[model samples]
Target: MTTEVIKKPPTWFWVVSVIALLWNLMGVGSYLMDAYVSIEQLEAMSQEMRELYEGRPAWVTACFAVAVFGGTLASIALLLRKKWARPVFIISLIAAIAQFTHWLFMTNSVEVYGTGVYIMPILVIAFGVYLVLFAKKGIANGWLK
Candidate 1:
């Protein structure tokens, strides 16, 4: 008896996967820069926003960086349909939710200037759900590996 394997993805999957990789890579770069650089760098980017370093918590920064790196690695594994994709995606899903919560619940009620529009929060929620559920279909179907 031979086990049949599914092969190849729809063209859209390739397109979405590329988009997801680019998105995750940006997260990796932003988190890395924020965690390592001085507050002056962030202040220069946003002069109105005050730094909230809370004792300069290294652990918090490390964990945040790890979450971003996990997403980056998962996006890479996704291209190959590696088994690690699901767990990595899961981590990203949770982190995305946590980030969404922080923005929605923890931020000040007063709006900051140049926050890049209010629609960003909604887009993030939509993208988080899409990446977690639909993006991994190829991995499940054995087309990714």
Candidate 2:
């Protein structure tokens, strides 16, 4: 009988996986806050902020949900050493790009929120891409089965 050897992941693998989980959890928290903001909370915002929040399209919200939730699941899969993490991370990355595309191009978010608004979306997309590449590398290195 032929035997198969399982490769052990490096320390960095665990570190990255944990970071991914925490990042995605924060995304999920952001999504929840946005999705469930109360009327009082909305009224407390400045006119521009209120308009931006109330005027967001439903599809953009859907994309946000998919991106954050998918990333969270992919993070869990990575921690579990599952090969499925790669594809899920790819999906999350695509959704994050879509969500950010709307924020960057289809809306006046940058103008309303000032240049500072760009930072989070840019970081989100960058991290999404990084996680996808990391998962692929993990699979290739036999760190993820």
The model with the greatest lDDT is: 2
Give per-residue CA lDDT, model 2, range 22-141, as digits (tens): 999999999999999999999899998898888988999999999999999999999999999999999988998998898889888888888998899889988988998999898788
**What's the CA error at residue 75 for candidate 2, in Å?**
0.3
Per residue, candidate 1 scores C-alpha lDDT tens digits across 1-145 of 9775768777877787778789879878878666677766666654335434343345555555655777778777777656667678777767666654554456542365345644665675577567767646765776765
Q: Which stretches of candidate 1 lie above 4 Å from their native place?
A: 1-4, 42-48, 51-63, 109-118
Q: To one decimal, what is the Cα RMSD in angstroms of model 1 from the true structure?
A: 3.5
Q: lDDT (CA) for every model shown?
A: 0.65, 0.91
The per-candidate count of clashes, in order, stands at 0, 0
What lDDT score goes with residue 99 in model 2? Answer: 88
- Give lDDT: candidate 2, residue 65: 95
Instruction: List pairs with backbone clashes in candidate 2.
Output: none
